[model samples]
Target: MKILITGGAGFVGQALRRALGNAHTLTILDTAPAPADLGPSTRWIEASILDEAALREAFAGQQAVFHLAAALGVRACQEREDIVEQVNVGGMRAVIAAAVATPSVEHLLFTSSSEIYGDGEPGQIFREQDEPAPRSAYARSKIASEELMAAAAASPEGARLSYTVFRLFNAYGPGQRADFVIPAFCRAALQGEAPVVHGDGLQTRTFTFIDDIAAAMVSALDARAPAKAAGSLEVFNLVSEETLTIASLAQLVCLSAGERPRVLHRDHEDPAVGRSKRFEVTRRVADNRKARAALGFRPTTPLSEGVRRTLDSVRAGSGAAEARG
Candidate 1:
């Protein structure tokens, strides 16, 4: 299939490339420059998601599009609220329009975040049916984007839209940015510095490996697998059952990096200064049964192994961009 991935140069996007590049003709539509080693079948187009002409050009002859472009990360969203709505919300609209306008386009798989279910209690379980409590502008923008796609499909442009929403929990692996928890812990461990834990160290999250995330995404391409609701619109949580506390992950990273992890607990008055994203949830565990039955979505990589791999990759690419991946 011919495919286009917005924000295709970023970490998760790169993972998708590694997963699906061999089988499909891939075109990357992103404002960022192309990566060094995009294969022969893959091409890069320098454009933002907000550009309709650019998106239309890229969407041409494409059978599917993975909408990964956005103001990523909680901090970036919190810091840039005005632009987040413009990009996250407006960008989805542009992508949908481009897809609808294009004759060949059939499927669109959006990579939404777990942050859409914000402010859950400690060890709280999250399901797709839960009402979204978006605490930040970022999560709210994602909610709006999901709604936009659903509403658009129910409209006149209903037939060609094969839309799926994946609410991805904490995905960690090689080439992750330092702003993320795994990379930060690994970097601190490598440098023998104290890793900071925002709020209580007991806060837990399910961290799925980047490779597993990519695999789940690739499997989502099987249009027969997703829910047959609303004429094939599906929403699934892409996450692992492996849950760990923030402090525990830090300690694991330290051990993996050959250092004894000393976790420093800090409760700050300003949430922006804290490592935790502003108004973020304390715990989020995904229900992956739907993904497993629908898309054969399974994450096999162990957390300890994933941490080791991330540490090695980060150490090798220390001078690269921060908080990306």
Candidate 2:
């Protein structure tokens, strides 16, 4: 397949590039260029997703376009709401429009977020059928983008475009930004600094491995699934069934680093943080059954193993700490 991936410099994009390099003709478009060591088979184009002309040019001759570019990171999104909205929602609109305009683009895979199910009622595993109740600005923006993509796919112009929207949940592994929980904890613990545990550290999350996510994306691309049927959009939640609390993860980080650091909760005056959270992921876990039947999708990496691999990568890329502010 001739594939075009946006945000190809980002963690997930890098993983996909490595996984699909030999099997497909890949063209990556992003606001920044990829690393110098990127494979020869992968072509890089530096362009913003909001640039419709650039996106159109990138979409030309592409069989599938993975729309992964977006303003990400909880801290970044919380600080820059306008920029996040513009780049995430507006940029997604541009990508969908460009795909609709290009006849050869058969599939457009959009990476959505599990944040849309924000703070569900206790013990409710976020199912695909639940109505979205977004809490943060970032979550709202993602919901808007998902709606936009669904609308575009239902239009006459988008009749031929195949859409696969995956609502990914807490994907972690090497190459993840330092601002993220896993990488932040790994970097701090590796540097002999105490891993910062925000609030009381009881917030829970499901951390999916980057490799499993890439594999799921490939499966979705190759599956015979309809983007929408019966006036509703088809969506899949890509996440691990395993759940871990922030405190537990911090302890694990300390263990992985061969050091036990004291957990320091932020001061009450430092803005209230770490709201207790969980997602009703029941249907999401069940949807894997559908993926398995249709696409032969299966998550192979366990959390402990994935964390060990992430720690190893952090050790190898210790220079990343210098890049941190």
Best candidate according to TM-score: 1
lDDT of 1 by residue, 187-284 (tens): 88888997888867887889999999899899878743323433356788989989988988888888888897679877755565554445756778
Q: Write down the TM-score for model 2.
A: 0.88
> lDDT score, residue 6, model 2?
95
Question: Which consecutive 10 residues in model 1 have the weakest lDDT in total?
Answer: 223-232
Tell me how many clashing residue pairs each candidate has.
1, 6
Model 2 clash pairs? 124-280, 125-280, 125-281, 125-282, 126-280, 126-281
RMSD of each: 3.1, 3.8
Per-residue lDDT of candidate 2, residues 178-248 (tens digit): 67878888888887878777666776777889999888888766673334332334678777777877778
